[model samples]
Structures are given as structure tokens and as C-alpha cells.
Target chain A: MSDANDGAATVHLTLDEVRALAKAGLAKTGLSPDHVDAVAETMVAGERDGCASHGIYRLLVAASSVKTGVVVPDAEPVLDEPSPALVRVDGKGGFAQLPFRLGAPLLVEKAQKYGIAALALNNVVHFAALWPEVEKLASEGVVTLAVTPSHAWVAPAGGTEPVFGTNPIAFGWPRPSGEPFVFDFATSAVARGEIELHRRAGKPVPDDWGYDPQGNPTTVAEDVLKGAMRTFGGHKGSALAAMVELLGGPLIGDMTSLQSIEADGGRGGSPIGGEFIIAVDPAGFVGAMLGEHMKHAEEMFDTITGQGARLPSQRRYEARRKSLTDGVDIPAALMRDIEKLLEEA
Target chain B: MSDANDGAATVHLTLDEVRALAKAGLAKTGLSPDHVDAVAETMVAGERDGCASHGIYRLLVAASSVKTGVVVPDAEPVLDEPSPALVRVDGKGGFAQLPFRLGAPLLVEKAQKYGIAALALNNVVHFAALWPEVEKLASEGVVTLAVTPSHAWVAPAGGTEPVFGTNPIAFGWPRPSGEPFVFDFATSAVARGEIELHRRAGKPVPDDWGYDPQGNPTTVAEDVLKGAMRTFGGHKGSALAAMVELLGGPLIGDMTSLQSIEADGGRGGSPIGGEFIIAVDPAGFVGAMLGEHMKHAEEMFDTITGQGARLPSQRRYEARRKSLTDGVDIPAALMRDIEKLLEEA
Candidate 1:
């Protein structure tokens, strides 16, 4: 079976079939069927939402982690409810998504009681793209802010050590259109995933995206292996990455990016990768305020974009709409691999 | 007195003297003494905080707005209690800073109760840097996010039109150190204020900080008149600016940038400016968790920067500490001018 980067290869599969295929791939690793479904569901949704790097493409990495016992299934999460508005969850070496799925609902519940809820997860795997969870809350009229400290793969602004991950932040607000508005991006010049993909393809990276050892810009992904990933916009992006590390890493007890690289195989343990999620119930704060604000915001967004501007989640919503109408767009290479795995299962 | 750009040079009065001078200047314009003092306090604090662009230096702009009836001093803010966590304040043609001050305390109060509070403001003259207000809340163990939209003076990623303002987003989070981590920055490459300052000083703008009319990079501020301000990181910056416009503009019933630019005098009587602020009480969610998380975060920050990485607010905090002990570093030229202004007053 070929991969998407293997050139002109794309296989079409229905959303259900894709989900099933992903589940089967996960199941092949001797995982419980339900958890497998959840992982596959998230991956497929990620692919459907145009986040290919975080989508089914990541299944191999997850499988590898499972085989290495880096991802422990059936591990119970340690949740400490410190306040009505905050919960701290220790992943206890389980699948990262499970704790997040469990914690998000609990956070929303707490937010409903108060006006906001903050949940921190330690000892969890990377939760992939942070927007999906945020979007789910936004749809329920909750404004959410999510941050995560990633595996060490990015360098600071002026350094040459991949001492920081592509630390990302996701912010979302509920809207009247039910589509909501969400913004999520890494603080890196380019996400580390792109670098990995480039390396896998034996391709050179864009000079602007990263730097080689000695802090010189290079187009070689393999060079990034020895050097560091540059921050976006120099100092500003570096500052943001630092803040994310503070908020998402040690603040939540996750290993620092620098420490992650020092770990064996670069997979974080102890405090699972730190993730912080906050949900605010607009109705709780201002009642119909969010609704009114949404109405006015729609007008403003409309006026700005005029003919062509779209909101953050807008493209994804459009993609989803199109998918529901004409089925999801599944890459051919992914489908073939999944089919093979399904048959093997 | 001649303006800074009028070749009159900057007058760096003692912080106390600067505030008094601004108050006196406002008082001469038929503003109530209290209103004069409030506005002066905010403006002066801006300069003290090293935000010279929005600081006491902008007194000229503030005076012009008031004289032109753009900033009404005696006007009262129309307050609406939409929910326990949200408050809407119609600036009612008042000084933007005035309403912000009034709303800040209210937000803190509500945040303490609801765990999260949002205050939206519309129909006011420009307010200075938002960090000060958010920082005040952070001192009380609250996290704050503030967004403001101003006149359109920036372009989208690929376009050449200044379709958005150098809109800024300010955020604050409290750490165990009792010093809050605050970030305030414009979505544009370099804020128009910074560019104007450079232009006034006949200094060239930094490459990658701005572009010329032909979409070419230039350091000449004069070129900005013909060209447009480019977004910071191409598409990412543009997306962020658009997000700020939506969440900070129409979301607060303020006019969108496009609409304001289309209106009379580009902004006069436009009532298009908008502000959005959210404050969340950590006690509401995490209880004792904040201490632990923040301590860990500080440790991480220290370790990462042990190699000399600077966090977002580290410089400001250091500067502030120095200023308090050894006195703030006032530019020699600026100091002389301020002395002259004092004698004249």
C-alpha cells in the first residue's frame, strides 16, 4: 500500500467505512473495541476536517506507541476535582483522548454550574488537533480556550535546539449561526508535523520554516534533526511558545520540551503531556449576551469578509456540509492500507 | 505646545507631573475634574508601562478627539446586566478609558461570583494598552483576555488594502509568584503606533515588519500612506486579525472596521470602536490547584530560560522592578522637553 505523499494516490471511502477501517487498525493492536472506535473516530474526523497530518496518517505512530507499551490501555485516570470550576486529571499512562473526552464533559458540567471551568490533564498523549474538542463546546454555547505542550521538535526564536514542540493554542466562541468561530494554530513558523512529513519524504524543508545547526535557515528536514525549529515571527512566536510551555507543560506537570528530548525515545511519561482546557458558559455570564454579541459579530464578520472572508471553523463547516451531502473525501492510499489491515484483523 | 511630530520633540515629565499635566490639559476643556483625572491616569500609566505609543504622548490625539466631540467626557456609560457573568456597557460617546475603568471593577466583582465575567464596550474613543487593566485582575488570581478593535490601518494577508486596524489582543494569567504573565500585541507586523514613532524619528522600519504599496518590503513610513500594513505571518496573522474583528467589534455592537472607514471622516461619529474583556477566577475552578500549577509553570519557565529564554512578561517585570528601585529610564531628550513643559505649565 502507498501513502498520500507517495504521489497521485487517493482512495475514497464512506465516513462509516473509514471509521470502521480505523477501528480495525486500532483493534489489530489488541486494544479494547470501544477505545479503538474512539481513537479511529477522532482520526477520521481530523482527516475530514482537513487536518491530514493529525488524521489517519498518525495511526502508525499510535500503533507503534501501543506496541512499545508507551500507550497503556485500560489505565484509569486520576481526576482531582479541586473546585467547582476546575479539575486536574492524571492520565495514568492511558490513551490521551480518553481522559480528554471524559474531562471535557466534566468541564462543561462545571462551567454550567459556575460560568467557567478549567481542566488540566497530565500524563496523557498528544490530543492531536485541539479544535475538535473546542468546537464541540462552542456548539453547546461555551467559549473554550485550550493549550497543549508538544513533544520537543521546535527550537526557540534564536536557538538551534528542537527544545520546544509546535506549542499550539485553540480559542473558540459560540455563534448564532451554530457554526461557531474557532481559531487554532501552532506557535511555530510551521507545524512540526510538516517537518516530519518532509523528512519521511526525503524532501527539503522551506528555509523560512526552520533552521539548521548554527541557527542558519535551511531547507533540509534532516538538518532540523540536529538543529532546531525556528519560531514564527521570531521573538513574538518564541514568546508565545514559552507561554504555552508554562501554561501547558510544567504548569500542568507535563515534561518540558527540553526534558522531553532528553527522555528515552522522546516519548513523555511522568506527568502525561500537559493539556489545559477552559470552558465558559456565555449564558452563565451574560445570559442572552452571547446571542446578541453573536448577532452583531456576524454582521461585523460579514462586513469584513464582504464577498469572500470566512471565519476559522467556517471552512471546516463547509467541508463537513459537503461531506454530509457527498460523502467524505478519503485518500486512496489510506484506504488501501486500512483495507489491508482490516482483512488482516 | 507643538506636537512630537511637529519637531517639538517629546517631553518626558515625571510620571506624577505627566499625569497632572494631562489632567490639567483635560480640565481646561470643560471636562469634570474626576473625568480629567481618570483619563489622565490611564494615559500616563501607558507611558509608564513603556507603551510610549499609547502613553502620555497620545494626549494630543485624545484632546483632538474630545474637541471634535468624538470623546464626550460627561457622558455616562449605558450598562446592561445580561447575566451573572456578562456585562454590556455602551460607552455612550464617552472617553473609552472611563468606561473601561468603571467596567473593570465590575468585571472583577462578577468574576469572583460567576468564576468568569465578560464586559463588552462600544461607542468610545480609543483606550490605551489593555495590559494594565487585565493585570489588575490577574493580581487577584483571575485570568483575563481583552480584545480591542480600532480604525482600519492594516491589510489582510495577500491584499493591499488596509482593511483592519492594528487590532490587539491582551491576555493575563496569574502565577504563584504573584506576578501575572501578560501578553499584549497587535495583529499587524509592527503596530501603526510603532511605525509612526519610527517615522517621526526618521528611522527606517525593520524589514519583514511592513511593506510598501507595491506589496514590496520597505522601511519608509511615508510609504505606508500609499501602501497598506501587512499582516504579521501572512495568513495566520490575517486570520487572527479577522478573529479579533469579529469577537471584539460587532460582538460588542461596535462598528466593523470596513463600516467605520466608509463612514464620515473615517471615524467621526462612527461609534465603530469596540472592546471585549473576559476575566475568570481561578478559585472558581481549581481551588488549590492554581498554586501548584503556577509554581510548576514558574519552575519550567525558569528552566527553559535558564539558557536565557525570555518569557513574555519577564522584561516588563524586570523593567518595572528597576523603575521602582533605580527610577525608570527616561530618554535624555524627552526629559529635557518635559522639564520645559513643566515650567510653561
Candidate 2:
């Protein structure tokens, strides 16, 4: 049941089984059935694509947040028609998944109808990667960009204290066939979990990953967890992070990461905030030349791969292909944690 | 006139004088009078913002490109309304400056009318920073994002050869008062000009800035200029650069960086490619609450600066404020080269 070397164990589960497990755990949190269904799909996608950290592992975070009363378990999300080309979804302080799901169709429709569209989801507890949202839009034949600000756990490039989130930006581009090109990444040099893992393993973190309580760069993971993290690429990443805050926060008429964390009230729950999504139809720009333009995109891909450079999401897509045939493996302890939630419910 | 140590000579001129010089040199390129006026504004803006490279120094490059017939000095830009929300401008192989100028008003108008709009500039010779375009849109009280791919001079992360451009991403947000917030930066670790400057000074480049011909990381700026530069933030920046290429190139139905470079036929002129720009009107998202949302934005900025973290465009804005009255300094040697062009005309 365990791998002694890493003190870990895994359990294999088919894609359907993973979804069922996620749904059960989400249901245990008293989320509405329809909302649970929407959120579970993203969890399954994460697992299928080898993003174990964002996969069913998030079920624990969700359940815990609901129990802490930081996230609304069953509040219905409300869609707002802000403009012809702007869609706003008030999550009603619930999880962002359902609101995003409800808004996406309209976003895609608006993009096709108006050439471009923007979606803003506010008053939501965010606990998922942005890729799922962008990917969904891309599948509907559009280019998508999504961004969100997490809890302010990272510092600006020149600042000693935390002033920005481990903000993430996700982008997706539709392909002529097969899986879309997608990338979702945090601006933080490293994720908080990575530092926690290092701490658990009694190892030092890499420089630039984080700083000590004194605000000086340190490799001590524990200190960083208690202090602050740094953004990737220093100031450049900081700039991007600030941009995320502006777009997903104030622009969306929602809370900044600092405000989001304060709303959490030291509960260490999922950050309560907003998300910004933009969708653009290729047809709007290229019209009948869509196919021709897509071919040009493929040429770009070929050159990147031909030079032995892998495009973003290529490995994830590859993992997905294999996992679709061969079921995914979930860490046994994590599976046990999910089962615990179901049992409690 | 020469600085003893760096061998750089300075020439101080009023902003009016700078514009006159720029217009004179641009006229010598056989550019249309109106196009010259449009392009000259951007050049003057660069100088006033203390960006010497993008300032009047670019005049020499423009004149040389026109001389080689690689750039269409007098080509008229054609605008097409592909859709109610999209504006396409065929620069007809001329400077992007003129195309952008002709397209800006339409872009702003559409953003206001439709809430969101796109402006695509194709078949253009680009020789300027993207800030001016975004800033202008911001001046019109809208949020803007602009991206473009330069010639392929950068390598993808973990790749050995060049497969990407020093692609830049620029963003602008309108402020309640004062100038709008703006940032434009290349995804490359550093600009190609920085490496060339280092090479000229017989200095070694920093690690991760570039690689040798074999693709191994190197500190020799010369090797990097001949081989390939690396993207900033390693893989994250690489992903961003690829996104820029997709959104600005194929998405706009124009040439990719590699294609653009090849189209140049080794003339080493400005890259003939396309630019993609998006503008969003705040009123669409926040309605009459636009002022309230912007106040939230100011709060975010306050925290960043309150913690002593400088915002991305603060320095440039500060430079502009001072230079507006104090004027800007130009290198004496560069001025000589530009004046020589006027003499030849």
C-alpha cells in the first residue's frame, strides 16, 4: 500500500471512476448537484492530463473550505448580461466552476457573434486551474485567455512583503484537429505546494523560489511557507502578476488577492475572488481563410517540435491519450482522503 | 561632447527640436507627408519617454530600409472592417506607425460601440515599441493589449535553435486621472539590442540571456547574437512568446516571426509582420460603476507602491513627465548618422 522511499502509495482508477469520486466528494460539501457535475469534470480532466496536484487532490481543499463556511456550498450562480460583448457571472460566493460553465457558452456565442467577448466571474471561491475554462472555449473554435489572482502569498520583485498573488494566466488556441494548444501556469517562481513538499522531504528549496521572514532569499522551505514567495523571472513576472490582479480583480469588479485573503479571514481556505476570460473567434479575423490560417499555425508547431522543442500542453495531451486508454493512478493517501469525505457525508 | 569612459557623446534638444529632426529624417525616406507625421509622433514619444533606442536613433534604420526597398516608404495603408467588432489594416508593406495611426480611431470607436474590439495590422514593417499604440488607446479611456512578433532571434526553452521571436506583450489601463498605466516588454530575456551593445563593449552577457552556436548556454554576447537568445523566465516566458506569435501572427492571418525573417531576405531591415490589438471599454463591464471599479484599481496600485514596489510603467511615465519640460538627451554620434540621411536627400 506504500512506497517506502517516498512514503507514498497510489491507486489506479478509470476516468469515469475518478469523476464519480470527485462528484461524491463535491456532493459531500452540499454543493448543488448541477454545480458538482460541472466542477467534477474539471477535476477529472486534471487527473487525466497528469496534473495530480489540481486533480482530485483539490476535493480535499473544497470540502475543507465548505466546512469552514468560507465557500458557499449550494448558492446558485447568477448570470448577468453586462453588454453585447461582455458576460458577467456572479458566483453568489460559491465555487467558480459552475458560474464559469454557465458563462462559457454565452462567451463563445458572443465571440462568434461580435468577434470578441469578455467574461467576468466574481464573488467566487477559486480552487481550480484556469486551463479548463480556456480549453473549453478553444474547443468551441476560439482563442481564449483567462487569468485569476490567488491569495497574496508572493512578494513583488522589489518588495519585501507579499503584495501580489501567485497569479496564473492560461491561454488556449484551437487546432484544425486533435487537442488544442493550451498552457496554464502560475507567475510565482514555484507553487506553495512544492515548497511544502520540500519541507516535508527535509530538503532545501531553490533560490528565487521564496524568502525568509526577514525578507532575504532563502532556500529553507519552511521559512518561505511562513514568509513569502517570489514570482518567476523576478520583475517581469511581477508585472504580469499585477496585470492579472488588475484584470481579474478590479476590472472584474471583484476582490484583489489581498482582499480575497482577508475575506477568507485566516481560514486558509480557497481564495474568494474573480476570474477574467476573453474569447476571440478566428473567423472574425480570417473569415473564410480560417483553414489557411490554421495551417500556418501548424507550421509553427512543426518547427517548434522539429527543433526538439515541445509545445505547451503537448505532454499533457500525450498523458491524456494514454490515460484515456489506461486509467489514471491517484495517490492512495489522497484517495483515502476523498473517501473520508464521502463517508462523513 | 564625448563621455571619457563610455565613449558616448550627448546632444540635448527640446522635444520640439526632436520632433523636427525625426520628421526631417522621415521625409528623407520618401514617406508620405501624412505617414511621416504619424510615424514621427511615435518617435518623439519614445525620446520623451527616454527610450533612446526607439527614439530618433531609429531614423537611420528606417532610411536604410527604405533605401534597400525592403520597406515601403510611401505605401498607403488600407483599412477593412471585416466585422462590426474587428478592424483590419493592410499596411501595404509600409511602416506600422502609419497603419496604427489610421486604425486607432476606428479601434477606439468600435471598443466603445461593441464593448470589445480587435485591430489587426498586417503587411507592415515594424520598427517601434508597442507602448505608444497601447498608451493611445488608454488615453481614450479604454483598456488595451497589443502584441507583435519580431524576427526570430530567440530560442524556445530547452531548445537548441531559434524558433521564436523576441515577441513583446504590451498592456494599458486607463486611470481616473493622469496618464494611463502602460507596459511593453519583450518576452526575450533581454532585447537583441542589449546583446549587441554588450558585444560592442566587449563584455560578456549574463547567463541565461543566450546560448552559443551549439545551444549550450554561454556568456558571450556575440555568440548569442549569432546563435539565439533565450526567453525570460525560462519556460513561462517561452510559453508567453509562443502565445504572442499565435495571437499576433496566425491569428491575424499574417506571417509568423520565422516567415517574417525569411521575407526580409537577409536585408536585416525591420521585420515585415502583423500586430494584434484588443481594446475593452470599462463602461461595458462596470456600467456607471466604472469610476468605482477604477478606484479599486488605484488601491491595488497604492499597495504595490506603498510596499515600495514600483509599478511597471512608473519609471517611463516619470521620465516622460520630466522630459516634457527638461527635454531628452540624444547621443551625438547617432545624431550625426541621422543628419547624414537628410543631407543625402
**Which lDDT tens digits does candidate 2 get at residues B1-345?**
112113367888999999999998989889889878988998899888878778887788788888899888789999999888899999999999889988999999998888889999999998899999998899988889999998988998878688788999999998876688888889999888888788888999887788888888899998998799999998899999999999889898998898888887788888888999999887887788878888878987888889788888888889999999999888777777777788993
* Clashes by residue pair, model 2: none
Query: Which ten contiguous residues of candidate 1 chain B have the minimum total lDDT?
Result: B1-10
Worst 10 residues of 2 chain A by lDDT: A1-10
lDDT (Cα, tens digit) per residue for candidate 2, span A1-345: 112113357788999999989998888888889878988998899888888877888888888888889888887989988777889999998899899888989999999998898999989888888988888889888899999998988888888678678899999999977589999999999877788788988999987787788888898999998788999987889889888988998877888888887777788888888999999998888889988988888988888889888888898898899999999988777777677788983
Docking class of 2: medium
A27-78, model 1: which lDDT tens digit per residue?
A: 8866666567667878877767666666776676667677777777666777
Model 2 misplaced regions, further than 4 Å: A1-8, B1-8
lDDT of 2: 0.86
lDDT value, residue B132 of candidate 1: 78
Q: Indicate the residue-level lDDT of B253 in model 1.
A: 54
C-alpha RMSD in Å of predicted model 2 compared with the true structure: 2.3
